[model samples]
Target: MRSTFDFQPLFRSTIGFDRMLDTLESASRVTSIDTWPPYDIVRTSEDDYRISMAVAGLTEADLTITQEQNMLLVAGQKSEQDEASGQYLHRGIAARAFRRRFELADHVKVVSANLVNGLLTIDLKRELPEEMKPRRIAIAAGEALPKAMTKQIEAEKQAA
Candidate 1:
């Protein structure tokens, strides 16, 4: 059974969250999603992550990984002739075309990808800009003086 949710009231006052809300709504209706090529998302550090997908029969040539804005897309397709030439009694391996999209947070970017022992490991890193990072504000000696003290000093200077 699918449950319907009303997000109108919840998102009425939100800004810059349209895509995020849409993604959440779409994810709730998960009946249409394909479960092939199981994957794992691991956090290596505070800012680094890795996505490992099991793609036993696929090569780097057969897979395509694309990053558009905050969307990470991974897709795979096998040739029809390859399937026609071989017939298996019990085909356990899946070479079917599949597309998977991951919604990345802001500043997240793909670092590297490699196929090792049938595992497609994709490394990702979240790089925060300098302006967004925490910075220390150096206190100026004169700036720290109270306004009343500075006014008194100015008055004293004028009298002198």
Candidate 2:
């Protein structure tokens, strides 16, 4: 007797995203074991996205944001003086070293980033080509036909 696993389908079905499967697979491997510096991802528009990280103790000079290949990297490291003088009875804020990466889609570009009230906001916008934009086409009637066809049409019009 054959095992139950033998009845499984040979090939799985994909909706339409064959290329995105690799991205999805890679994303699944990212285990959420580190939650020191929390972040949020928000979709502002159809092609606009924003990433906000709660970096209260991190200054602009301490943070670095860059795009390498297709990944957006955000890292930070506090100054040595700040680490030495800052004394806390119960320290909960993250001020050591950290790096976070986000995968970007094709043609998606980072517009800008700003730090306000201890929150860092990174904006991204996708720029599509002009040929990819939607267009409309108008159909024209055969109103301005040649005289030969016009004569045949007149003869048929007369016959009718």
**Winning candidate number (TM-score):** 1
Could you give me the TM-score of model 1 versus the true structure? 0.79
Per-residue lDDT over 1-160 for candidate 1, one digit per residue giving the tens place of the 0 to 100 score: 5486767776888988888788788777747757888999999999999999998888888899999999999999876667888668998788889899999999999999999888999999999999999999996665554556344344444554
> How does candidate 2 score on lDDT?
0.81
**93-148: candidate 2 lDDT, tens digit per residue:** 76779888888888889999999988999999999898987889888876776566
Show the lowest summed lDDT stretch of 10 residues, model 2.
2-11
Q: After superposition, which runs of candidate 2 have C-alpha atoms over 4 Å from their true positions?
A: 1-19, 30-32, 86-88, 143-160
TM-score of 2: 0.70
Query: Candidate 1 — worst ten consecutive residues by lDDT sum?
Result: 149-158
